[model samples]
Target: MRLVHVVTLVSEDGAYGGPTSVATGQLEECATRGHEVTLLSLWRGGSRAPAHIGSVPLRTRPARALLPGRFTGIMHPLLVGDMWRSMGRADVVHIHAGRDLVSLTALAVATLRRKRFFTQTHGMVEPRHRLVARLFDRLYVPLLRRARGCLVLTERERRAVSEVIGPQGPPLLTLPNGVRPEHDAEVERGPRAPEVLFMARLHPRKRPDAFVETAALVHRKLPGVRFTLHGADEGELPTVRRLIAAHRLWGVVSYGGALSYAEALRAQARAAVYVLPSVDEPFPMTVIEALSAGTPVVCTDTCGMADELARRGAAVVTDGSPRAMADAVCEVLTDENRRAGLVRAGRRAVAESFSIHAVADRLEEIYRNL
Candidate 1:
């Protein structure tokens, strides 16, 4: 099958995060299976986008910010030329949709041409009460109803999509993000320096400030222990630095500016524990990556996978409080037997449930059905 993915933005900083990563993973999987796949998205910065993902083609246009600040990732819609000639080649178009230009354009093109398409919102299009969200739902929900399937990560997300689509809409499919399998030669992990890591975009919703606070608490308990923060700044770096300075956490905590995807994997492999202080993180791909790397995880109870992770001894799920997160990280660092158990169980959990091969098989089946 000729599969085409419309991921919104491919900025230099990887500011698009999970949605882009997931879409490319599928694109590479399809390519490996001898299917012709293409990634169509917008790009920014001087470094230049990659030529391809594995063997799949990567086609892009420059992304320009019409509205400034946090809204820059979504470029002006008119920047792209008519891709009807391009969209005409696909058997199916898979949109990593949100209220973004690339996704909307593909939806419009596919609809006008009567082509089959699927949407996976990646927790972006919730039933938000804000004026922007309401306005977007007006345009997006109708296009969603026309899709072959609307993929959601969690049950809450399913309800959110359902509420927006009303009583009748597209077939809502539950498809979790899949991690690519690691070789058996992967490195072993344990308690080490940089005992805790907070890796994700340093945005307000992700609660990077809370991580800083947690670091201060953890430092007070274990003076010699270290904490590291690694991610691109999404308008919150200044605040994070201010908090770190205010708390006098200069030596106890270090900032490792930004990490590439490969760097992130390596960092997780060596770290003792990975913590994401964010609440309502539906399914944290970062935690899964850490688990796959044999590192223990610390996250909030509000995560979609928290119950399962905690039950299976794969992670320590807390109440998202700085105090709670600090306690969890310290425990993971000091408790040898418990830490090993978490590593073993986390790897097991990832292999059993989050493998990319199974997701690829299901996707192929879905494409054929469509």
Candidate 2:
């Protein structure tokens, strides 16, 4: 099968976040299965072409900034042409992120070429502002309706998207993101350090400030514990810095900045606990990486993976509050038996359910049927 993935941005550097990681994982898995996979994405920083995501080909074009602030959309005219040609040669086109121009262009090209395409909303359809919600309902919702199938991370997201697209829209498939199984072996060796990791963009939505506050609280209980904040600074870096200084946790809490994909996996493996304080996280790839590395996790209950992990006894799901997160981290660090149990369960869950091979098998089935 020839598969093409259309996403906003992707780089060999660690500039991108979850969506790119998920796309790359799926593409690599599909390629390993003898499928010809191509990733069509906007190259960040500058124009780069003919890059390889392992064996899979990466074709990218320069991105034109559309808005002033961060998290703004990139306008890539070449994307439409690229998708038109790629879709003509491909068996299936998988579009990621619903509320983006790239996705809208892919849908248009797929329809024009009479090709089968699946659009996966990385949980971006929900709008917090009334004006944005109105725009999505008027414009994006119709484009989503044209997709052959829609993919969502959770049942909650499926329901929310269904409400907007109506009952007559494309079939929605629930597929959580998966991580590479090889990470389990590539993990850092020896005894894990007394470190808690918070790896995601420094955005308010991710609540890096809350992670800092939680770090302060945990430090009070476990003085030896260290907190590391990884990932690129999006918007909350200043706030995190302020909180770190205000709490006088200069050495106890340090920002490691952004790390490459491989580096992040090793970081996860080295840490005692991985923390995600985000709210309404559809599905975090970091959580999957943590579990795959046999590391326990402490995340907010609002996360999409929280319920499943909690049920499996693989993670400590806390309310999205600093104190609650602090307590969860403290418990996981202090109790040896509890930590061991979580590690075992987390590894089992990743192997049995969240491995990329299993996810690719399901995706291939869907693509074939489509």
Q: Which candidate is the best by TM-score?
A: 2
Q: What is the C-alpha RMSD of each candidate to the true structure, in Å?
A: 2.3, 2.0
Task: Write down the RMSD of candidate 2 (Cα, Å).
Answer: 2.0
Candidate 2 regions with alpha-carbon error over 4 angstroms: 12-15, 46-50, 68-72, 127-137
* TM-scores of the candidates in the order shown: 0.93, 0.94
Candidate 2 local lDDT, 149-256, one digit each (tens): 999999889987887788889999988799886777976677889999999988889999999999999999899999999988888999999999999999999999
Give lDDT tens digits, candidate 1, residues 1-370: 8888888877666667888788888888888899988888887658877887556688887777655435424665553443565668889988888876566667888888788999998888767787866776677678888999988999988988888787788888888888876722354444466568889898888999999999999888888878888888878889888998999988778788777666677888888789998888988888888888888899999998998898898999999999999998888878899989998999888888877778888888888886
**What lDDT does each candidate get?**
0.81, 0.85
| Model 2 clash number | 0
lDDT agreement of model 2 with the native: 0.85
TM-score of 1: 0.93
